[model samples]
Target: MSGGLARCSGSPDRDPGLQPERTRLAWRRTTLAVTVASVLAVRTALHGRAGSGELPAVACAILAWLGFVVVAHQRIRALSTPRPPLLTHRAALLTAICAALVAACGAALVG
Candidate 1:
């Protein structure tokens, strides 16, 4: 047990660049944006003249919103650890899928 190992002393004393806090804030903002977009997509689906054509867009928006939520949770949990976690391939893939869904929803609204 004499090995040089730093015990968990709760929070760090010195500021670690506040990078984790910034990252948490960024995740929150992204979640908010996704929520707003999803709401808008639902509204468009309800009022659009294309009938069922906008339903897929709404579905995609909802899925994107859920994906964002999962990401936010993962991000928060990762930030809580002593060593910040790197962005995994799964996160990148989820983000890309969400972005594409949002873009599709926007295009559906326009066209």
Candidate 2:
């Protein structure tokens, strides 16, 4: 009766530990925290009277959030599966870049 690989059979990975759910929740929390910081950056840029410099900083902050959202959304979706695939190098790189952008914008705004 056995045929093909277990993955190909579309069997849901039995995970009694609920680790996947925990990971998904952690991702959601991280997204929320980053979003809050981004909003604060925008607020500072708009209200600080930084003039033209504000535009680029605000733009970068928003762009970073968007990039992070794309990656986080993908991860979140993957976590929904019973047996999610391993995170790829591309995804990790993009995530780091996005986070760096957000942090840079935050620092620039604060200073």
For model 2 the local lDDT of residue 100 reads 87
The lowest-lDDT stretch of 10 consecutive residues in candidate 1 is 1-10
4-102 per-residue lDDT for model 1 (tens digits): 112213456523565656676677788788788778777877877865567677777888878878877887667654557797898878877886788
TM-score for all predictions? 0.77, 0.82
Q: How many pairs in model 2 have backbone atoms within 3 A of each other, for residues 3 or more apart or on separate chains, i.e. clashes?
A: 0
All models: lDDT?
A: 0.71, 0.78
lDDT, model 2:
0.78
**Whose TM-score is greatest here?**
2
Model 2, span 29-106: residue lDDT tens: 988987997898888887885565678888999999999899989997786666778888998898788888988987
